[model samples]
Target: MTKAHHIIIVGGGAAGLELATKLGNKLGKKKLAEITLIDSSRTHIWKPLLHEVAAGTLDSSEDQLEYLAQAQWNNFRYRLGRVIGLDRESKELLLEPTLNDEGEEIIPERRFSYDTLVFAVGSLSNDFGIPGVKDHCLFLDSTEQAERFQKNLLNRMLKAHSQSKPIEQGQLHVAIVGAGATGVELAAQLHHVTRLVSAYGLDSIDPAEDIKLHVIEAGPHILPALPQRLSDAAMRELHRLGVTVHLNQRVVEINAAGIVAASGVIIPAAIKVWAAGIKAPEFLKDIAGLETNRINQLVVKRNLQSTRDESIFAIGDCAACPMDDQGNNVPPRAQAAHQQAMTLSRTLVRRLKGEPPLDYTYRDFGSLVAMGHYTTVGNLMGGLAGSMMVSGYIARFVYLTLYKMHQAALYGWPRAILISLLHFLRKGIDPQVKLH
Candidate 1:
């Protein structure tokens, strides 16, 4: 009897989870292939929502998807383990043993053979060798880190409010090290949430007087990745909200008190957030002798298959696919990852049927940045055969549609609509920002 072909997918982020859902529904139930998804965490949360999670605007308990539950619904196997090594010749993936919080072995190290493999481990914040950053700053790369910051923020506020004497100096100061989408949105959301938190019985603290937010960026202006007009609009809105904007300031160190810039200026703060850059996990550098870029992203061909091995594929932030059109590589963003996931899904389906897979070409759909419910700005492309700028409520509507698009891709139309309605109903009943 012929062995059943197996397809293994490592990582369960936006791309991996969507791909697994699609492929499993297509092949797993039909008994054509065994679909397996391995991830370190048992639940999945959209990475873009991490900033809001950190700021307490979104409750992770309701938003996160349980991997095992999803696997059961989507007809796929979920394995809880980290991929430690790969044996190309044997076509087996070596998984490291998993340990629980109490140091008990939850899953032992084992090998899972696959006819095809897909890697979508995603990326994390890049400190760029800045001194004291790893020790003093918080990065919203995962749900755990976001929860830690939120808890710390709540504790700091309570301690300051309960103090007998006057509010101490630098009590609610927050320094954000980047002015990109994450940093800008986080700063704006924090401003709103801080006010809400104070109004919700933390009477000793004043949002306008006690809280301080500073956004430091090395570029000439904030939101450098977006169009100048949109960036200007966001900057103006942030300034109107009383957020100090420090442009062209490169952080050299993240001291306990604050951040030190290259210009010899020190900014003091009670909490610091590092949101500047991102790089793939360190382990990918030597994985299977693959050629990786400076940030340790695997180099892949136009077909989205790794150059070192055709049977292995990568997508999302972990793969570096060059673009000859602009003489630059694809930018690491949620849209890029979602697009790549769709492309790979189609290609792999064709390959399963013994047909040639097509080359993956990235379409440049413009970018959008949201500053909470206050406002939104973006550039729209492929509109009426041209591109145009958009802002305000209309842009906010479009911004929300992007998330819906992601949901539609994974859950289909009916389920996506139901889930969205449920989310809205829950939001109306619960507090907008998490207080605890």
Candidate 2:
């Protein structure tokens, strides 16, 4: 009997999970190939929604998908562990021993052999070795981090509300060290949630006067990767909403009190969130001697295969794929990852049949920024409508559809539809914002 082709996918991010589900249904269900997904976390949550999670505007527990449940339903095997090392010659991936919260080992160190290995481990916040950032500031890289920020925010608000004296200047301020989509959207989300907090019986605190939101950007403009017009619009909205935008300000250091800028401007904040930049996990740099970029992202060909190994592939923020001859690489985005996952799924299937791989060309459907209920803004690329800027309800609807698209990929249309309906119904019965 022919040995079943084994495909191992490391990391259960958007791209990794979708690829595993597709390949599992297409091959694993038929016994043509064995599919396994490995992730350090037991559940998966879309990374884009993390800002809302951090702001306490969205409850993560209600939205998370359990890895074990998804794997069993989709015909794939799920392993919980972090990849520590790789052996290219032996085609084995080494995993660190699983540990519980008390630091006791649950699963011993393990290794899995694979005919094909795909890396989708995703990215982490890039602190650039700035002083006090790693220890003093908070990050939104994972659900636990986001929830920690939310808990801290709640405790701070509760203390301020219960105290007799008036809140001090900058005592309730939030310093977000980045004006990228995450930072900007998080500022807006927090602004919206602060108002809701007062309505929910934290009436002693004035949301507009006590809660100050600061966005510090090293670049000249917010949303630097997007169009200038969109950036200008977002800037106008932020200013109107009382959010302070500090442009061209490089952060020199972060302390428990606030952030110090190289421009000699000091902003005092009780909470600081670092959303500046991203880099792939450190282990990826020169892992198994595979080519990688400065950010530790594995350099890949147009086909999403690593430059040095045909049996190895990468997607999402962990892969540096060239977009043009001028040396422009594909920008790390959810859309790009979704597209890559779809393309790689087909490529893997063809590989099983001894066929040539399909090349992937990123189609920029557009970019959308949802800032709570204030509004959504984005540009639609290509298509009959051509390039156009949109906002208001139309833009918000499209922005939500993006999440639906991601859900459709994982759970199919029927289940995705039911999930959406359940979410809507749950909102009516539950608190609009997460209080605990």
C-alpha TM-scores of all predictions? 0.97, 0.99
| Candidate closest to the true structure, highest TM-score | 2
Estimate, for each residue in 1-436, the C-alpha lDDT of model 1 and write its tens digit: 8876788999999889988988888888887788999998989998998988998988888778899988898888999998888888889899989999999998889999999899999999999999999999999999999998898888888998899988856778999999999999999989988888888899989878889999999999998877888798899999999999899999999988999999998898989999998999887886878788899898888888998887888889998987676668887888888888888878888878887667877787777888877888888888576667888988888888887888787778898899989998998898878888
Candidate 2: list runs displaced more than 4 Å: none
lDDT of 2 at 263: 96
**Candidate 1: residue 226 lDDT (0-100):** 76
Q: For model 2, how does the per-residue alpha-carbon lDDT over 27-134 read when each residue is reduced to its tens digit?
A: 999998999999999999999999999989789988899999999999999999999999999999999999999999999999999999999999999999999999
Question: Which one is best on lDDT?
Answer: 2
The residue pairs that clash in candidate 2, if any, are: none
TM-score of candidate 2 against the unseen true structure: 0.99
| Model 2 clash number | 0
